[model samples]
Target: MELQNRREFGKKMLGTTLNYFLLESLFTSQAFASSVRPVATHWAKQLTEICNDLKLQKIPPVLWQQQVEKLFNQIELPELLKFIDFETLTRGFDYPDLGVNTRMVKFPKLDGLPEKTVFIRKIFGMKKGRAIIPHGHSNMSSAHLVLKGEFALKHYDKVAEEDKYLLIKPTIEKTAGVGSSSSVSDEKNNIHWFIANTETAFTFDVIMVDLGGKAYDIHNIDIAAGEKAGNGLIRAAKLDVETALKKYGKQHH
Candidate 1:
């Protein structure tokens, strides 16, 4: 009877110890997740402030680019994703079999904010071999941050104008992935394209525009059909939104 009691006590103690460890682990993980919330909150506040200031100050495009890059460089990929509530922001669209699809992160509607204030954020989800069709912004500025996977980005300087086409001079071409960021403005490397180099990829963009100014237009270009215009410049053919979307919509399944 004494041996039976001892065995029962031993089993009870082992079970208690196991339960205690499991609870401890669960609490630790929750605590860790909570600890990162503040960091994410800080980033959200900072971005809001920057966008607000841009609206009031209308800072030069170069300065705007520099400020945005500085802020983005401070955070690494893991930290960026940790605080971001992807489930809340994401609309959960069906991923296209090929090419890229954009999902806009819905910003909470704020009281007293103007109806036309241009503050936009979006995620570009891309499948491998698909590309973000070449396009340029009009009277706007944007920052692109690679949140996941890999992409090959090419930028071109809209140097001069030919009769109906923009004479674009190749600026820089490079591969970018998590932690990589780039910016575009009305001036500078405004014309750009990104090709997904991984099985799946995502890019986060914060875009600000002057709604009262001109309706921002994405001037699309066809690189394959571009003609050399000397001095390393190429005259790219302009493509309407519908044509551009149809042609570069899909590359592979």
Candidate 2:
């Protein structure tokens, strides 16, 4: 009986010690990670943290929008752009001028930053009277922050999906200037249209399409051609890239 008691005590001590070590290790790792990627007005890092949390499914997509809006509201556009090396990049960068859509540019992540691969970061530039077009996606979420000029931004909540159309209802319509922003998720504010209202407009974006490990789909909605649905909704047809740009990009109003 004495030997049995001793064995039980030893087992209990071992379990306690293991738990203590495990907790210590966890705290240590968290601290190390925090040091490696401090998030003090480092706009990119904060965005990455959210992207990581998002891809891990720790936070729902709808909540991702709130966090992104908060971040954009907190940071200045020039500061954010400098961190991402935007001026250096566009100094000599060139692209074919588009009459209807944005020019998407992918810049390298700042060196020494911790890796966060769940999302793709990009800058979309547009001429006045051009747009980002109206589009909805599956298994994706994105945030767009106006960095250069103004845009007439519109958002829609996808009500239903059919073989050829996405039934959606308008959710937000407003003029967005520098530091203004919008975000999209699969279930909320799913379709977004951005028409540049300035001579030149730029938006820095973080897009994650590989949610749930399933293939993502981009459905460009032809808003004007959408069939009227009851209850202030519209069944918009999906369009090809060329068609979408030509059709919706030049529509300023």
Candidate 3:
């Protein structure tokens, strides 16, 4: 009888081990047998999971976009503000002309957010008439959620690339308000520009770049100087960062 009992106990342990491995593989792209989890967080753990999947390319881009948009729409804005101490960060902040002030978002130790995250998270602040400039990204994915005020948000689909310009057409242009959100990837809506429409506007950003360890680039454009191409397209001349900021940053009219 003791021998039989030992056999039963061994079977039970094997079953439990299989169950654990199954769950681990399901949660991550890599099988548990070989994979190590990148980072852990107590605050915004769900966000971290999504970003991990994004970096791993475990989900489709459309699905990722939907997930990010739904996440912010469902976020408890008030709770988030309190958690991040938004008021303390933005209070008495000096405004910049035509550009945004970028602040890194750090989850407090008390909140159990690790010093390192799966990806970059940021808060961008802009004064009225200021803009984040027109830019396109490659080999990256990002999401922006409006936390306060409003922005004249615009998006353009990449048509073609020139030696010195990006040919794009407007795909989205709207006054995005609090809780409004959008996602960008090279696959869709690769280009974006944000102009603050209210006294002050703030957006919380989720950024994941170089998912496949490929070279990534940001193309800043001088939209004002671009000649209109046919079919509502514009051939926006690319500009260096300093030149783009100087030309496009002041009080976006």
TM-score of each: 0.75, 0.77, 0.77
Tens-digit lDDT string for candidate 2 (1-253): 9999999999999999999999998896566445433333366667778888998999999889899889888876555665565785456444334434334444333345455466787788767887888899899999988888899999999988999889999999999998888999997999999888888888888888879888898999889888888999999998998888777767544
The residue-by-residue lDDT of candidate 3 on 4-90, one tens digit each, is: 999999999999999998888666433321221222232376777777787788876667777877777776787667556688788
Q: How close is candidate 1 to the true structure, as a TM-score?
A: 0.75
Pairs that collide in candidate 2 are none
The TM-score between candidate 3 and the true structure equals 0.77
Clashes of each: 0, 0, 1
Estimate, for each residue in 94-205, the C-alpha lDDT of model 1 and write its tens digit. Answer: 5675457887764332333333435688888877877888887677888989988899999988886555588888887999988899988867888888988898788888
lDDT for every model?
0.76, 0.79, 0.80
For candidate 2, the TM-score is: 0.77
Question: Which regions in candidate 3 have their CA more than 4 angstroms from the true location?
Answer: 1-43, 110-114
* Whole-model alpha-carbon lDDT for candidate 1: 0.76
Best by TM-score: 3
**Superposition error at 70 for model 3 (Å):** 0.9
What does the lDDT read for residue 30 in candidate 3? Answer: 38
